[model samples]
Target: MTVAALAEVADVSAVEDRHVRLAGVTRVFGRPGTPKSVHALGPIDLDLRRGEFFSVVGPSGCGKSTLLDVLAGLSKPTEGTAEFEGRPIDGVPAGVGVVFQEDASFPWLTVADNVAFGLRRAGVDAAEIARRVDYAVGFMGLKAFAGAYPAQLSGGMRQRVCIARTLVMQPRLILLDEPFGALDQQTRLLMGDELLRLWRETSATVLLITHALDEAAMLSDRVGVMSARPGVFIDVVETGWEVERDSRIVSHHRFGDITGRLWEKLRTESLKHLRDG
Candidate 1:
């Protein structure tokens, strides 16, 4: 993921579509010379291919979530440009969905309603909304809890509801910032399996920001490593797992190899971040 590589990716016409593109993008807080200024991210060059599951891993406080925010159009770059499908992002683009680490399910809304919220807000007709909600809810294995409120669901189930809500929108690209971080290890494994299935059935490109190297290695077609703050891609490792990959892949020896590679890249950066404090 060098700047030269990024330029080549942006120019490649072999792939008729690129779900996301970034060139020298940077995000900074306050004036350039101000003492209070913080350089969160910079000169990031990336091209996320359509329908690929890509994960980003780095030390905590390395601006991973800031990268997600930029991609989701929740924040703009202070320099350079960010684009989705070749168009500059002035706001959250169409056909892009986002899910966060926090529980996003509405307390008052039942599982079905929570999943249907976005479509309803967009003025989709009741019939269409019902159809999409039923599919998303059932697909997420929440049909049994369709009538259950967020208060009644387990933590993992609540995250599933959030994902179902995102799935219902049928986004072409999904930005996930530690969407499974709150779940227990076993639950995270199960959720990871479901996410793979969702990606397959929906054909959506996924860009996930996560601290879990195992999760990233098992779930992504490629895993990007970021340096400590003012985060930039250091390397992108190919997992070589098939499209039908799941958490079970963790038992494979290659999983350890991939995970170790990610850790090696991150370890120094993480130590650097800690030492700086």
Candidate 2:
């Protein structure tokens, strides 16, 4: 699977309107008798458009990860509703994929085998799995190491394997919870570029969570900032969707201005949390 070939398979240019809607979503954390029962999320009302790249950023303990779980249907809300394609999300929605912060590539499987595993579980036939696996491996440029086990790959390569596995499922909605946070700076950037390219090619509805403001701005169609602990949306900044940037966004003249604005919003919310604590 060459880059051009994989691009063809993953291309989602024809996908029509597919959006997720969440209304008054909330989650609580703590044991029954605990003194520290806490609200991890809103009452959050939000909408993610089809083929959009959205990112959520906030201070530590701000429940950014919690939001991702709710979307993934890994955790149900204590209140409100989450919906896909206009239907209430009662459980893990079909055609949804996730990439975690931790390495999730199967340790025992070869890179190609790991990528194929998810497709197999989804009941895709063997021929289709082989075609899709090769396409994913080629798309992510993992062809050289397709036979390598997870233990034999570097951190970044293993992460690509994780991504390839997710892609083979041909999901329409993808959630990434700091998928590149575990890598070193350079590798993270490379992976980020790869991810952006892949997203553009797939046109998947992506919701990425990151602590890095610059990363969020560079990759997202909109960036949502949340208040610390007991999370709520403090501000959301929209960058035009369907635009492509090959240059470094941070080095641009307006970069500092946008980043500073996000910083202050986060800082103000964080201060409130500290005072409450």
> How many residue pairs clash per model?
0, 0
Q: After superposition, how far is residue 97 of candidate 1 from its true place, in Å?
A: 0.5
lDDT at position 141, candidate 2: 95
Residue 15 miss distance in model 2 (angstroms): 15
lDDT (tens digit, per residue) of candidate 2 on 9-31: 65543222548888999898875
What is the RMSD, in Å, between candidate 1 and the native fold over all Cα? 4.3
**Clash total of candidate 2:** 0
* Residue 228 lDDT in candidate 1: 93
Distance from true location, Cα of 24 in model 2, Å: 0.3
Question: Which lDDT tens digits does candidate 1 get at residues 1-277?
Answer: 8999988877776345777889999999788779999999978999898899999999988889988888888899999899898899888999999999999899988889899999999999999999999999889999999998999989999999999999999999999999999889999999999999999999999998898999999999999999999899999999999998788899999999999999998899999999997
Which ranges of candidate 1 are over 4 A from the true structure?
Answer: 1-12
Report the CA-based lDDT of candidate 2 relative to the real structure. 0.86
